[model samples]
Target: MAANFSNSLVRWIDHRLPVFSYLRHAAYDYPTPKNLNYWWNFGSLAGISLAIMIVSGIALAMNYTPHVNHAFDSVERIMRDVNYGWLIRYIHMNGASFFFIVVYIHIFRGVYFGSYKSPRELLWILGVIILLLMMATAFMGYVLPWGQMSFWGATVITNLFSAVPLIGESLVTWLWGGFSIDNPTLNRFFVLHYLFPFIIVSIVLLHIVALHRFGSNNPLGIDIKYPNDTIPFHPYYTIKDAYGLGVFLILFAGVVFFAPNFFGEPDNYIPSNPLSTPLHIVPEWYFLPFYAILRSIPDKLGGVISMFGSIVVLLLLPWLDRSPVRSGHFRGVFKIFFGILLIDIVALGYLGGKPSRGMYVIFSRLATAYYFAYFLVILPVLSKFDSSRLLPKSISTPMPEVNGIE
Candidate 1:
């Protein structure tokens, strides 16, 4: 049986793209850091999460209708008629939240450990692109329900691009494919939402490929520096990533089964009516900080531009953080800035849930200012003034490079 399977696989490989050699390099023979903890598992874990999303989303789509009138009802029908449809829907829904959670942790792990430093910059940039795609996909998913929040949220969000100068109104029309976000908008969002994940999958593959070229950064932000520090991707990282994946799955299953709708908005249960808006049109929790930024300014265009600027600023972090040091462990000023950024994100989240009013608006501006300050003022200043402890150079130093080819 083993011989037959191997023969078939070899034949198939001969007929298709060259994959075994790359797999051999990346998984079996490739060297990696033996010191790497479970945190490093997130890259693989993220790939798995994406796969789960695509599979579940495709299944859900089998029953989904694109029309506004029947879209919500069709979802309900899927819930009621399709066997285990509820389970499927909940898995996809909570899976999105879970996906974001892991990705955020992944991003932070990269940031905290200086995974975005030279050689890894492309991978990190790819990560930023992935994050943007995820936000767009999630927003489109929200709109699919055509729920009250979905309706108003679409209106409010789509209108933000109108903050542009001459092209503003035209851009809105282009986005809508018409006068407003009606049937055409829903149709495009549905198509693009379905399509974008495939693009993300490709990007993620590129991200890993880039990561393989550089090897991963360690928790200490030190070079592999020695022979014993690294190990092969298969035995070392495979085990670590599997363990993390098991733990993540437990959390995922918990959300799917117990608190399925807990992260979702209650108002989404109601269908969209343009004339009627939800009491509050808050986006998902993951989007809270940006939402806060969007409502911070009285000037529509300024508020819109600032909200986008926050994300654009994240992309420039590799260029911005000129600190000789990598880890927050050693950089005093960088540590403080990291703390401030965390607090600012929380404050922005709070503002997102509140009414766009006196205190909320003021605090939103404050938090928004702090948000930009972290990457712009804080990071740049720290990189300039923060003194870092020196250490051994290269992955093959005192800390021996592991399984990777030297």
Candidate 2:
């Protein structure tokens, strides 16, 4: 009787609002490629990470003070005094790193499989926009604690705007809401930090809608040609994603419980002291590659442009690679280049964390050069000549069994 009543209620709502029908079509009945692999799991993982961040952030904000004088103490109070505050703070702190890790993997998977090609160009662009927004939101949130790194890091990064031609200083002043980083800056950062996540959520929804329109690209990178090439997203991919989430949560829990400060800088433990600058100042790990690029160039304005251009290049990727083939799996030489590109990026990230001196500068310059060349020169040139292997007819095509499993 209860089940029948529930079914009837759902039917009544579906007849008017259709929310149930919409969810059923979008989540359960959506057609997904049958050949998707573990790499695809990162997309769903990123969504879950976003949800965790939002929930934990709100909880932390309830006890956080945005004023510079009290911000540091408030964070400490939450860590020591508030109920389950330590757990919430740790989860929120480490969740940022986990979120970036998932999103980066998702991006690389897209690039590797040509998920950015053809009909999905806008989808790729939207993803890049989300990345930019995430960067901004993270930067703002980092300042909320009002620690040593938070203050100086904010000072240095906001000063980068001074490289703009005419309105640079004005823009910086406006950003700070004063001549320098002070109470106004902290308040502004706090408000924006609280606000940007919701903006990110909105973009995420649009991203989902965009993704569902074209369906997901698979490991094979071939277009679906038959009913057998696809499976319902519910029982198949949903179960696969949940399994991935379980593994991810284990790693995340280990970090949160065992080494909550793994990604944090020790300098941030100290309160902000404008009079005493630390020996070394650096942004978060996720921002390192771009930071390296920013410092690589000698000219301040040039460095700023190069750093921003690095992201702009991603927006142009759909057009930059004029290749007919979508997947790196089918492109032999391109695969080798892609491997080198990944190594170069990792090297840049490592160098970003190091002092901008001696061998670090040299390597950063080389990596930065290769980064642009890979997209602007190499991809365009290779697109004209690189030959791809013959692709499978459809996602349902059978392959020879490996290790005699079949």
Candidate 3:
């Protein structure tokens, strides 16, 4: 029979390579916490977005000329002449924003559920590394367009390295591949932009391996003591993820078709002009909060340190928050502070998008202070003294209503 032959063929190959068995264990037979909610969907969504980015980027690169003189013209040609090039470019262009959106949600979910604690510290660290790499890759890709904003954005950002004490200017020169941003700079960025995604894919595999070691953290933030606390990842979560993907694609298609330039700066449509500088230069929306933090401090070196410190604090969160309990559901005070932290970040982002003048600078400094204080001071103090409700026994255990968190 056809089915029997297929099974025999699979067995014959799987015995030699074990690739099918590995996939079955990783995707189908893996145990995941049953209490995971819609928030968990973002992890899979992020992976899907990365795939979209990689495939579309490769196609775009086929038509893209990475030299500064030809880059902008080539992009225009792709839009005007190449068959379906506009669609591919739009998908890739808008996909970056959507990718950040998904990853941001996934990160906040991890923070809320205390997924970074204990055995998962390395997992959290790896996630942060991925974020850093994404930032680098996105920055490089932004320059490849060779537009007005892209040119000035690169100039200003690369100049930030000059804030370093001794080797600053030399480092900047090395980065630029000459005295300034030119053809060489663009060529190098093109190569790195093409390369970082595959590196990300490798880290993602390690992330998955680390994830399966500890299983998944649930909304309850409790360990799976009973076997019934978990379910096979395949049929249940796979179907759930597919549904999420459906909804995400609808939104993505709407953006690509109706408002592909929704996230783009108008200045970027013009070719790069080294002599002319735009009135206001801003990085992409995702980088705004860090930009605000960077500009908030008075000294250049201090600002750079603070900007990087914002992420470093997150990397140290597992050791920083000494709380006995995990999820914010059991810690009312921590939950309130977490909400305030989110608002502070939003305020910082808004401030970052605006000119660094008037009340914007003042508010940004305040928000930046709170951003560090929440992680450094608030979390440590709360961990020691906050009266958290008792935790449930396991992921499947019925949580008692202390103040109605259930």
Candidate 4:
């Protein structure tokens, strides 16, 4: 009866706006690979995280004052005076970290499954664009609190633009709205930070349209040959996505309620003091790997170039990886290198948080070298020689049952 009612309502709505029909066709009735694993859940997880951030951010913004003098006090007032304001603020804060976690996993899954190949290249590129936008949004949002780290972080990052040859100084001045970071910078950052999420949403719609056009890449990295090779996105994958969401929320809630400041810097708790800089100014954890890459270079201009290049290099991934087979499961040699790259990135992230001198600098340089090599040299060479495992004929091919499950 419920199903019939839903159908009837959808039909009635379809006659007007067709919104229900679009949702049903694009979401519920969309054909997805049967062999898609839990890794595929991250895309939906990312979308959920984005929604959480947007909603929590809207609530927090209601009470936020985007000013240099009052910004920090405003945040304190939210925590101490406003109704359940702490909860909203904590969710927004922690949600940023969780958002990146899901996105990184989603990107890694795409790399592993060869989701960027051929028809889906545009889809992958759109994902990278979203990532760059997210980084900018997060960085601007970080500055809104007008805390010590927030002030210095904004100063350090904005100054990087001054590394440009001809227009560097003017660009920095324009960005700062003066000789230094101040009220104008803070106000503009707040405005852009609030605006960028909606921009991300718009691009995400384009990303989804591209995705639906090509369909999903499966674990096997093979084209769907028959109806059995695919399944409706509704019941099967929706349930899986729901389970992933529950687990993700558990972790997010843990951080929000139990370890709210675990990912935050102690320096951020202090109000911005331009005269008294922290001994070592570091960015949020998610930017650490690239931060390490930036400092690894000896020259300032080179470091800035290298830092931006690390992200820009990802744009070339679809072309960099020349392997005939898409899935790392089949490519024996590529899998080993992929693991090494993961370890190298984690090592860089750790080293990024520490003082950038002595052995730390050496290790960071080495890791940074390998990081570029993985994309530029390792993938191109290995693609030609890596031995691959035999794949099943189709996504629907039944394998030996694991324990008694089909």
Give the top-scoring candidate (TM-score).
3
lDDT of 1 by residue, 209-255 (tens): 89888788886677665666677888767777888889999988988
Output the lDDT of residue 277, model 4: 90
Please tell me which model should have the higher lDDT, number 1 or number 2: 2
| Clashes by residue pair, model 2 | none
Name the TM-score of candidate 2: 0.96
RMSD, candidate 4, Å: 3.5
Candidate order by TM-score, highest to lowest? 3, 2, 4, 1
Per-candidate clash tally = 21, 0, 0, 0
Report clash pairs, candidate 4: none
Q: What tens-digit string does per-residue lDDT give for candidate 2 at 237-356?
A: 889999999999999999999999999999999999999999989999999999999999999999999999999999999999988888887777789899999999999899999999
What is residue 55's positional error in candidate 3, in angstroms? Answer: 0.2
What's the CA RMSD of model 1 in angstroms? 4.6
Give lDDT tens digits, candidate 3, residues 236-263.
9999999999999999999999999999
lDDT of 3 at 349: 88
lDDT of 3 at 316: 100
What's the alpha carbon RMSD for model 3?
Answer: 2.5
**TM-score for each prediction?**
0.92, 0.96, 0.97, 0.95
Candidate 3 residue pairs in backbone clash = none
